[model samples]
Target chain A: MKISKEEVEHIAKLARLEIDEKEKERFAHQLSDVLNHMEKLDQLDTEYVEPTSHILPIHNVFKGDEIKEVFPMADPLSNAPQKDHGHYRVPKIVE
Target chain B: MDYEAIIGLEVHTQLLTKSKIFCSCSTQFGAKPNQHTCPICLGMPGVLPVLNRDVVEFTIRTALATNCRIAPSNRFARKNYFYPDLPKGYQISQYELPLAMDGYIEIGSNETKKRIGITRIHMEEDAGKLIHGENLGHPDSSYVDFNRTGVPLMEIVSEPDIRAPEEAREYLLKLKAILEYIEVCDCNMEEGNLRCDANISVRPEGRREFGVKAELKNMNSFKNVQRALEYEIKRQVQTLEKGEEIVQETRLWDVNSERTISMRSKEEAHDYRYFPEPDLVPTVISEDWIEDVRSKLPELPDAKKERFVREYGIPEYDAGVLTSSRSLADYYEACVRLFPNPKIISNWVMGDILRELKDDERGISECPITPGHLTGMLRMIEDGRISGKIAKIVFEEMYRSGKMPDEVVKEKGLVQISDEGELLIFVDRVIEENPDMVEAYQKGKTKLFGYFIGEVMKASKGKANPALVNKFLKDRLDCNV
Candidate 1:
């Protein structure tokens, strides 16, 4: 499972990350090494065992469907990079 | 060349819980922009989310309604994507193992009943709404409203079993009805509580393999969904007919142009990279809880329709129409309970009541006439207090004024003319004014009896009891005097 430079660039575009030309090569190698190391676990044959999704055995943690106090506009809007009419503003997106 | 279309739908229905899926923010629609936001829903760092118990119960209710097998233990995963509306840059959804799977919904009516397989139903959180316009006081910019950011959604995926666009529409209708029947979702398309995305493909006739598929979005109503699929099917068949390979892509249905346009090609598809969420714990549902929810389930449409035919003695078609909505069925039953004449009640409900409601574009919940008022008018006709024609006028007045039928009848002086003395004057005048018709009737032209009845009814202004008028006219016209 070797990762190519072109594949790395494609993934970066999908993630909306801005990567320079030189960094693409280095990151591709690093990510490929990480993936290869994780592949070693596939050697074990444990077909009868059930897959685990969580490390802890805790389950069914929930709260009642009741409304609590909500934060005012000042709480979230204060952290926004650009705010307009009490909403978060971003670059125009078509489609 | 004849080609067959294979269609499947993915529906996202917003649950009608009081709070958000993972937070305590109110999940009400159309609130002021960002008025329902909190640190948890806003995706602030170091903020943790607690699951709402109602969301899980609602999901289980939906699964049981659709005949799905629930997973004893299910967990949520993070679907990685990048969009401005997604403040967390990822949506928490289910993957690999979902809440329910391998369920089926029976669609169509009568001889066309077909079972469409549902692949899975999973829980997820909704993204914020994006408002793009120049009127936001900033040209060439987009505004985001986080009021709907963390609303709970159930993604129901169906297998590709639909053979035509019409079947696809029927499948959606049945699915929506079931969701509303259980009161899990409001199923309002206008309010964005329910949305659908379709996957469509066309292959040569008698071929077992499927052709390249295209995903369609942006259909705001069920009618649009059918029209879009119809257009996409034709487009795919024409492309294949021209010896061109079909390109896999995602298309948006343009309502004004009535055509599907490509939004993104398969090359730009996202990987998603789903992984289990560590913030929330997995849900372990016990058998006792499942049985409890099952016992509390309401009578579904199919069972209710069957009972209406057996118990109420109404035809299957009338039962189908009456039981289409829960509120409408309740209204029909209430009228039947009071009137105790199933066929007559069915006629009034299916005929005049439905016609007036359709004209006004209103649903049964917004109907002006209550069950008691409607039965009151029927009782007037039954007891000979008002003629059938006069009852119609009373019904119209009651609908317009929201008054009781008795009140409308009394105010308009619409009592039937069943008394012999009151009707005798109009009957005598009608016989005397038409001497030629009277001679014809004496000459044994028996069909002229209808003409006399018409003349008498006209003179009485349609307030005469038809049965009494028939008897009175026959007795008078038969006499020599």
Candidate 2:
């Protein structure tokens, strides 16, 4: 149940995180410990239990298709670090 | 070596819902940039995403129309990717469980009906529009429009059942027509309401295994989709012939170049770590609810097309062209109700009306000439008030000026002259002028009869009743001979 260092590095890259070599090794060890502990639950046999993505008892929460109050464009643009006429500006993504 | 292309299509159509999928922001297009966005859609911290009830209902309608099996329970997953268009680090999409599955859309290709298997239809939130700085004179940065963010989209994925590029276009068109019939998506590709991507691979003829596949993007129109797939298949086959492997990557259809250019990124780089969304709960649809949605489904394109052929007795091709849109089909049916000759209505609609609409890139709903106006003009032709040729001119005027058929005919003075007394003058003038043609007709050059009819028609400015002109010209020419 040991996570490889390469696996940790790949995970970091997918999350857009830049980690040093030492951090990659440390993360691999720590993540493996966490997964191994979670894997210990395999001892329990609840064959009839329905696997669920969320443990919450609630389901099917929906809002009607009614338009609420319209918010001003300036509010969100003000929070942006860089904006151009109510549009959020970011580095161009060519590809 | 010959290669057969195995193409699969992925289509994303924006649902015609009033509100955004997770927020109450208006889903109206062409608003000011970022005007329709809210905190939830902007991915602000500490906001719960609520599904819109209309989105699922629309999904049920679409799934039923496509003959898909609706999933009793489904949940949304977060697809993690970093792009400026997506305000959230991940897009909220369905991963493990989709809304519906195992559908087949039957399309007419090469005079045969082929059923393309639909793999799945999943609901997801649309990303925002990114206006690249280079295109807008702001060279280093891009502007983002969040107005399109959080728009509900149904991603319909088809199985690799399409064997040719033409079949792919047929499949896409059939799907668009179905969406239009259900009134779920606008299916306007130019406005980005309906977008398509294709996955194409070529294998040696009769090979059991599949060749490497490339994903094609940015095909904004159905024509471009077929062109892009054709170009991609050629590129792959050429690579295989050169003993070079076809690279597995995403390529974009360049409309200007008329070929697909490699996007220079491999699929491995876009590792979307998908996980179930914690905020939004699973949707569990009941049998009664599914039945209710199914009962509300409109008559889809295929059924309507078949009925048009059987009920109206029009050609299958005419029925297809007319039934391409729901409103157009309704227009045809309304015209038929007013005028019992369905074949004639089909000819006028498919020939003249659609030609005008296609030229202007307009829809039937936007047509100035309604079914009433069309049927009114057809009655004029039936009664010989206007000849068929003159009716075309009158119809054009009615379409252009949005006037009634009578008004156009009156304003343009396009009444057919069925009075033999009035047409006899033009007939005698033509026979008197064409002495050589007259002598030729007497000398058994009877093909000159068409020449006499033509001269009279020309002199009358195409207003003479063709039948009367023929009868009068024959009598004038024969009696003189």
Candidate 3:
């Protein structure tokens, strides 16, 4: 397989995902298959093709710098799992 | 073997925008927690991020000022990371195609001027503030304030051309001055309006290849940037000398400990996984837009400094000091309009005015003495209305009470004693009181001439015209009149 088990584990850790050993094995095989299918594009000889950044022809979408009223929704931190003092509280992440 | 340090700086300065970059929320500092966040900045589902029009204009202004080539087209990208400060799982920034590239700012200490290459200047969104500990009585959890989140930032990356820590400082100072002159950033380091991080490496003096490097962060001031680089370079040199490889890592400048400490190792670091932002459209810049930004750019520091020297005939050093800040240059020019003596005005501004402001740690804008008062005081010296010594006293009282120079001089009786008859009375008293000095002066003790002058100046309470006193004393003492 192009994607090793350790590589799959590393990728999962970077995304902060939790998976058991069986799920890791399955993801390794699945990711390698997806990459192998994507590799078929390498056979195309289209060196002159212009790389595409956006599919749409639109550009320069900007809003004026003037301040407008903020969209009033429910309290911003109301849905947090833990909140205090008008702040969204998370686990301690000090340096 | 002597080791040379190679340093590169990544300076992030917050732009002075009326609203946040991607949203319409007010970008005011010190707002309530999460007060400035909207659905877009907070990364809510189904929300799209739109660019602020002024951010692009301001970025173009800086790019032109730094001689950077603005990209014909640019787009935002997502820098994926996980931190409490970043509400979104990824930060919207420019990755491969930044707005501008290949700029340079000149820095010099002494007479040696050098160009420090600016690699890129890209626009990005700032992260929120993370509060740890029980500072706000949230003891058990870390709190995040999104007030600063999504505020526009321009990250200027420098080429790895800095050879020393002091050069790094010079580069930051020049960049800060340029940004301020262009009226783009406030350039206030204390309030987090401007931030800097540096990456440094050390190699033997004549070696070509670079050594392992450590990234330094959390330097709150420019002085701290230089100090941190110095400490890290020394540490790396020692590590290399001890036959140990310098570990590649990120370090934090511990303020209290006065040294750089390891913040994270390479093994624990995760890739940013940058990808083009799908929600935002690419920004295309035409020649007209660049020209429009170029035309509106203000007079930068170097050009203004040169003009000061050429037009005002002041020394290069004096012009450099006067044009250090835009307001200060304006102050000097205003005084010159009224007084028309550049060297004299430069002396007062650089010596007395700057000293007074520095003691209180204030900018020239906050100074109480106006240009009218300054030129008014200087005019007294020119018009023979007050002595130079007394003008110093008048200037202080004027600054303290925010009074005009004429009012201060009148209230304190600080006018010059220039009249010949008014001077003769004090002169006669001095010669009478010191008969030995007078006789000795008649016997060719010409050195005692200064003694007579001192006594007369004291009797007149330091308001005597020195030129008149000299003429009167020479006539009286040389012939025993």
Candidate 4:
């Protein structure tokens, strides 16, 4: 399957990226090429193999339900673009 | 032509776990903003996430309670989206293969039982809260509180089986009761611990296909959910009747306006590129673990209701009301143990106690009147220590003062006047003062006997035993001769 220009534009919009027409066209072709290359794996007969969600062989990685000391407010808001009363401030987000 | 509303609810209940789903940050509510943030929850560079085992157990517990089929293995996925409240720009959730599926919850009363299918129950991490600054005269800025971020939540999606607003509300109440019964969630809608969003559509009667649906949000209570759905159903039916198309959208239920405003159109749909979370491994639940959780499960609402009707000889409706909450059920059982008259106890609890609790916005656990106090009052009525009318006064005092029934009776001097010597005086006085009524009774008016009985009770200040007053009045009036 090939990715279309509209699909590329849709993905860009969802990611909140403003892509020009030229960039949309270029990325459309490049992404389709990547998809076509990835599709070559479908030619192999792997029906007996189970579909894997993760690459690792490990499962059930968990920790007990207990609280640990939280990071101080200064550490997280330090990297935020805007700070307000120990909270991260950003442009207003409507529901 | 009548149109029917088709509704489905998506409920997100925050699990009562100690920590966040994938971090060790405390999951306590009402904390200062950003106080619960850790590197993993804040999405700091190169930090990995480990799932909280309690979250998984809670999900399985809920699944089993709702009669769901638990998947032997489940994996987490990253639902990529952009929101200021979500620091990682993606929420870790179960998709494609959820923790449980194909479950059902029965709503409605015994005679009209309706099964609402649960399509899936998936574990997810909640996003943080956004404190809007529009009210503060700053329309361009908002503050993000990360306290709720990464908190364990279960998104329970129901199939489109609800046919009316009442059914939708019933479905939610039943689900909430089950959750509270299992002690998995607090199910506090006002505090946002349990939030519900509804998908509603309208179709003509006898139509097989579903109409275009609009998702409704911001319904803070069960009443609001019913009202919002009613408004949406009317709006959709009107739109369809006018030969107009129903555009799919997400609508906000404005509490003040009592209307749904379109928030987002279909064109603005986000493509949440879902993929497996690389940091977290798959969860493998063994059969032994499922059975252990099953064995720990308490008797749910339906089974308890049945047992109540069978054992207590109460009506199904009474059983349902008493067993609606675990605390209320315990209260009923305690009263039954003391009084052993389940029907009368049910009447008092369901009638007077429930009304008082509702008026004060209190729950059974917070009720001032204890079960012993209530049953003690009923015992006074049973033994004729106090008339039923006088018991009401004592009950009110007991409820207000948290005192025992006998204590209230003693304080008020409201004991019954059941002795013949005490009641005979009042009967003779009533007969002497009401000569015209006696003449009327002798002339065969007959119902004037009730008048004499009323006068005797009134003359005794309502302390006269009603049965004794009746016998004395009949004898004095010569009605039995």
Best by TM-score: 3
Give candidate 4 regions above 4 Å deviation.
A19-22, A70-76, B135-137, B265-269, B479-481
Chain A alone, TM-score per model? 0.81, 0.88, 0.88, 0.87
lDDT of 3 by residue, B1-481 (tens): 9999999999999999999999999999877788777888888889988899999999999999999999999989999988888878899999999999999988883389899999999999999998985786656678888888999999999999999998998888889889989998999887889999998999999999998888899999988998999899889999999999998888999889899998664447568889999989999999999999888888998999989989999888888888888999999999999999888999999999999999999899998999999999989988888888888899899889999998998888888899889899999989899998788888888898998989999999989998889999988887664
How would you encode candidate 2's per-residue C-alpha lDDT over B11-109 as one tens digit per residue? 999999999999999998888888888889999888888999999999989889988999999999999888888888889999999999999999873
Error of 4 at B435 (Å): 1.7
Report the number of the highest-DockQ candidate.
Answer: 3
lDDT of 1 by residue, B175-234 (tens): 888898899998887678999999999998999999999999999899999999999998
- What value does DockQ give for candidate 2? 0.69
RMSD in Å for model 3: 1.5
Ordered by TM-score, highest first, the candidates read 3, 1, 4, 2
DockQ of each: 0.68, 0.69, 0.74, 0.68
Off by over 4 Å in 1: A39-50, A70-73, B265-269
Which regions of candidate 3 are displaced past 4 Å? B265-267
Candidate 3 at residue A79, lDDT? 78
TM-score of 1: 0.97
- TM-score of the A chain in candidate 1? 0.81
True-vs-predicted CA distance for residue A49, candidate 1, Å = 5.8
